[model samples]
Target: MNKTIVLACFLAVTMIYSCKKKGKESHPEVKVVFKKKQVVYQVFTRLFGNTNNNNKPWGTIEENGVGKFNDFTNTALKEIKDLGVTHIWYTGVPHHDVITDYTEYGISNDDPDVVKGRAGSPYAVKDYYNVNPDLAENPANRLEEFKALIERSHKAGLKVIIDIVPNHVARNYQGLTNPDGVNDFGANDDKSVAYRVDNNFYYNPAESFKVPVFERDYKPLGGDNHPLSDRQFDENPAKWTGNGSRLSQPNFHDWYETVKVNYGISPDGKKDFDELPEGYENEGFRKHFEFWQDKTVPNSWDKFKDIALYWLDMGVDGFRFDMAEMVPVEFWSYMNSSIKTKNSDAFLLAEVYNPSLYRDYIKKGKMDYLYDKVELYDTIKHVMQGHGKTDNIPPIQEGLKDIEHHMLHFLENHDEQRIASPEFAGSPDKGKPAMVVSATISTSPTMIYFAQEVGEDGSENAGFGKPSRTSIFDYIGVPTLQKWVNDKQFDGGKSTEEEKALRDFYKRLLNFTINSSALASNYEDIHLYNRNNTEGYNDKVLSFVRWSTDEKLIIISNFDDTNTYNFNLEIPENVIKKWQMEDGNFNTNDELYNQYSSSLNIEDSKGIINMEIKPLESFILKIK
Candidate 1:
């Protein structure tokens, strides 16, 4: 060190201190207080508002009855809002390949060989500019109907989010209502080459597209007679499949109904567009937006950008991207940055399974949140199945502490098996404890599927979608949810006593989560401490503490399905010191439910609480 340099540094520090003190005096340093936690209610839009209870396997729209946009009445939305949800993710709202014929409305009939079921797969989006015709009472007014639903959702104190499958598009993509200057996906594609920088899709010149050979007993439309059900599709130059299969005839397991989008990355794995600049990973979304404003990109990138902006302009609050890892991170950077520029509060979430890419997706790609599937969800699932221990959870929380707030937690969504399904926990009651830990363990956003609260089993074998997972590909009614719908009255009149009880539990838990500032603030895992020190605290029990400057919470859950736990659960001396707790009996009340009587005793700098937890029960004790 140089003497002059040291002196200059000291002066700089002194000046900064002086300025900070003056700024504080004028600005009046307010107490730091976080907003309420976010709870997202994800609904399969087609199945949510449907009142018809008749669910037949492989049934037509007339046989099973499809839900319409008009079905989401104001009363229904108000009921959902009362569940303490801030956002509603409306799944399957876009147009896709469906077996139903709409030629009279100037909509081309989708070939059954190229479609998944009579209803269709939402991932294989057919049009970027319109809503699904099946969801509308009149096919011509589908977009208008969706806009009205958005208005209703907003009026009910809920934000609206929809899916944007940027990785691929329907095999027969169409833009029936493209804006004045917008063009369809492959309108100007040069099919002469297999890979091009500006081409909308990758091509296999001289090879025509072929439908996959079906397995025995599995047939499109159940081998019914239709002009477009011949297992024959017309494509002069076959494009790569959605999952990146280059074969002209993809395997049955591949995403055969969609075509892969091109984002300037060629077959040689060389980038045709400019890679992100140095240190761009640490830049904010606004800077990312500015970086791409003047840079020209591929056609698919431009088209998807237009589509996303289109929806945002129509009052959509945000988007949940499908299979986001399959697409390039650079494209997400451009897309998400552009979205934020339009609406800075847009909730952008993505499905990136690979844990290695989680940080990249959130930080560099400018995504608001990513799925915590591989670590949190999977570990919790194993625990519920009796094969995993509560010990395996805290390590995951510690590992992701740096990005924990950006990880969104959920129990069920469209892709996963329902909690009440035979393949899952075999009963919805087993999920109670897991839901508590998942929602309050960290500051992450909590999401619950539409019928999850009422214990939907997803056991119906509805055509293309099998048991254990609800069908996203066919017309079918969710029996459990229908009982709660009760003929569009939005009341649980037909629901069984057990079903209503489960929903009531969800209501109490979710309401507490959103209104509690501690849930969105500081956290510490006390599971290990209790296991080592507290007697009778087994691996089936999980414990933690969540606190803020204003509130303190001690949460404990029992995962055992048939065991009742009674023990003196210890809250270590160090944790008590953090809470500024004194050595005496503190007034405490269970925030989750008031059924249990809890007493806290602290003596000689040690804190302990006598706790009695029932099977699949959780207690959120608030210290007074």
Candidate 2:
């Protein structure tokens, strides 16, 4: 009897242990610090104050410097910060030139920003080490203004992210050289080349063409057959010219926006070399070898890692990598790891404009976040155009699930068209509600482009034209901009009465998102909500639910010009607390219970709980 009893006890203990092990394996909670998972507002410095629509020539960096990012502090940006944005991304902080030459034809209205000194494209960075003196704090103060801006941002409790162009550099800045004429740039021909501080390089998948002779101060390089070396390294290596692609062509120097890289000739393809040729390998092979060539940009990996660390050390939470697709996945993976180590809560958002490009970034864990351009584009453009409907909502919600941890959602970014006006073919007041609905309710982190809050509007051409428009924000201002920022009102337009109501509505939604675990939920389930059978429930009504084991948030946005929709929600009973509309209106007690789980009419124009939408509008309802 004693032996049997002992054996039974041992088996029971083992069973319990097995169950516990399985439980642990079945589900693991995420360990992430969401400092501010609410909403983030973006500011494009050039367009903050003045209404410069045409990128017309500004006097000089000296004259325009005051209007640049330096102006962002007091008005638009400050307003946005006050609106409760947890993060701010300032575009074009580093110097960028709009490389068009209007001199021969005379400056036209379409020219963006004129070449004050030597206007080159912003993407074609002249150098990373130096700050655009004009854009800095004092004319000669250097990185001071940039640093001060960062300090101010921190004091406001907002995390700031600046653009980093790791893939390319400027074509016209002249070679980095000493006053005595020593080509002391990163492209020196001697053993001390690695130590040189003048030149920069990018990762070359198929190395081609040798490093060209450095040309100083825009002086002509006598060498022929070299590509501009400013544009993207060719995807097709067979296109390489023996000497260099662009330089080899006559008059190629006239076009200074892009350039090809340097690489040695191979029977198969062009091979990149940092030091002198292989047979003449008298120099230190390891140090001199250019890592960016097929293998990796020699020290680029370390350099970027250090850059990430430097920014974080200075109290930045993360970086929004530009042109991420061009760089090697290994570079981002290393960067992501290093930044997370320094600040585990760091938000690494990659600007991989296309959703198809998100695979590698997601798989390698190289990026913790990416822009969800697909859903946003469809919601703002197609849906607003009256093409797709509510059924179209499923795919977007599903896509967010797959990339939830690394997703940043938005209706309009600096790259795309504004959400209001011609883009939506609706009034600024009408289009705004839909934008807010889409942004706040989406599973991904929301990003509000600079002029978004105030019902800003413009055309696609406004983004990249001539020297006329100083900044992107100069188009139009709607009250939504200030209201969302100051929390004084949620009004989508210029009306004061509407602003106060809208403000409360917005606050309720924002607070709900921040407090609940739904915003952080990554569940990809699609069948969880059903609105197909209801009348007027179509693509016009965008709806999705984000839920974890403990919490859930149901987001519904109407993109119709003026349509009433009834949609049914399948949710657990006793979850909803109160219904909060965009105008600070609410329904509770008996009214809520009577409408529970039923299709509620949304009458946006009538100021009633009817599901009637008045053009572009968004809604947020709180669950008890």
Candidate 3:
């Protein structure tokens, strides 16, 4: 071969090899064990590290105080990691609409009529390219502050996840830092058209958008005097509201602050883009991503894709999508497929409340996990509160048996009332048995809200947020969390005895789940069999068995909070055979605390043990 031709071939191979090396470096090898159950700790970023005790109703930032990016110091992240968490979901990081003025920093003033509270709702993202200024010590360095927190969290051995509200953007969406040549949402839209495949948002032709009329004495900033609190907003040819309100003048109860994004689906429910073929659900993300590479999708699809890639470039580990079901499942397939190609280990979780849509969102949309709210969480809550029986549980488990691993379980989140609240179980201890079930009954990941361990009852009557749920809208300090913070110590120094004990229980339970191999593998419900055969079994108790090649676990939890039950707990003969046990006596040790023990007698190929379970007690017994 000629020297010039040979040299050209060698250079081509070297270029290809260099590209491959860069790809590997771009997506670093994350710490992941396939099919291993993970624990997620969701902490409201601006609320997690706040040490302030002043929580006034409808208070300003100075009066109520706010948490910031610096609040999540190395010390704070370390405490969260020690709780057996693999991922820390930092909620409310993006720049959202706020009442605070940052005119000096070149940020446009957000009218109070379009903002949720003094601090603003995290879901109403104002700029996709910036971090919330309220979360920074210096408004100009907000993005850098958040990036530092991300690095700190990673160094502390916790992956970071943030929200991606795909259904909508803030009504006053701005792109102060959008990269050159990228147009903001609706910047090039034809306002005369109601729906267009290429348009970024759904428009209402010839109409003007108005702020929601006040209902029953409601006012912006609680009637405080602000130049923008005139009960008026300006939008010609008003866009559709986030929650699908068609009215230009949305009701006070509507999501008026956000405008829905158009995903190429027409107003008459016709698709304007190509649909995936029949068997695409079973295909891997690479194939799904490749298929869309040559297809022309809606403008909103590309817009959201750019935002996701930008965050991924900034070293974000994953996203917890809000209101995921509102958007088409096909969009998730396209968006999440792109995400997975960039970081194959990206943890993609979504809030899909509809049971029928769960599997589609998982298989078709490439979602890693979906909230198990409609079934497992709801059933467990019912039984814990003494409103339902354990008998209701086995059926739900049986129905979801095929996809159990894809269902993420949790007892408390930002949207739910606290377990210690009067509206809930009214005691932290009441959640112990339920927590065991939620965390250990399946192979899915388990999530705990920030302060759920020590029990923040969400009973504060902070303005814009009443009792029973933490206000994602207002700037306020979490009282129970502050005790644990103890002035940024993150040591729980001022926590009460009851709070300390509850936190210990959580630490023990969560640590065990991530370390145990059996939890992520096999499972069988022994509750039904024991209910019919056991001499003293009742409807208030639940029993299950989890096993793998490395270990075995028999979990039992008594939901009855008033009485200690002395019952002869029995495992079915079939379960004993499945465990390959011989007819003999085996010592039983509690894996949770290692202080409790009992004897399991296997007779005639059936396992039976004497049990004295106290009220709200749960035991993870390992037969040795």
By lDDT, the better pick of 1 and 2 is 1
List TM-score per model, in order. Answer: 0.94, 0.64, 0.94
Worst 10 residues of 3 by lDDT: 11-20
* lDDT (Cα, 0-100) at 54 in candidate 2: 34
Which residue pairs in candidate 1 collide? none
State the lDDT of candidate 3 residue by residue for 22-66, as single tens digits: 223222222222256789999988887677778888888888788
Stretches of candidate 2 exceeding 4 Å from the true structure: 1-36, 49-78, 97-120, 173-186, 189-256, 259-297, 354-356, 421-426, 459-512, 522-529, 547-553, 566-615
Model 2 lDDT, residue 79, Cα: 47
Per-residue lDDT, model 1, residue 45, is 85
lDDT of each: 0.88, 0.45, 0.87
Candidate 1 residue 587 C-alpha distance from true site, Å: 1.8
Candidate 1 steric clashes: 0
lDDT of 1 at 144: 91
Q: Report the error of model 1 at residue 159, Å.
A: 0.2
What does candidate 1's lDDT look like per residue over 1-624, in tens digits?
A: 333223212211111111112223222222333457789999988888776767888788888888888888999999999987999999998888888888899998998998998799999999889988989999998999999999999999999999999999999999899999998998899998999899989999999999998877888976678888788999879999999999999999999999999999999898887668987775656668889989988888888888899999999999999999998899999998898878877889899999999988987898878999999999999999888999999999999987887899998999999999989999999899999999999887899998999999999989899999899999999999999999888899999999999999999999999999889788888899888988899999999999988899999999999999989998888888988878899878988778765778999878889888889989999988
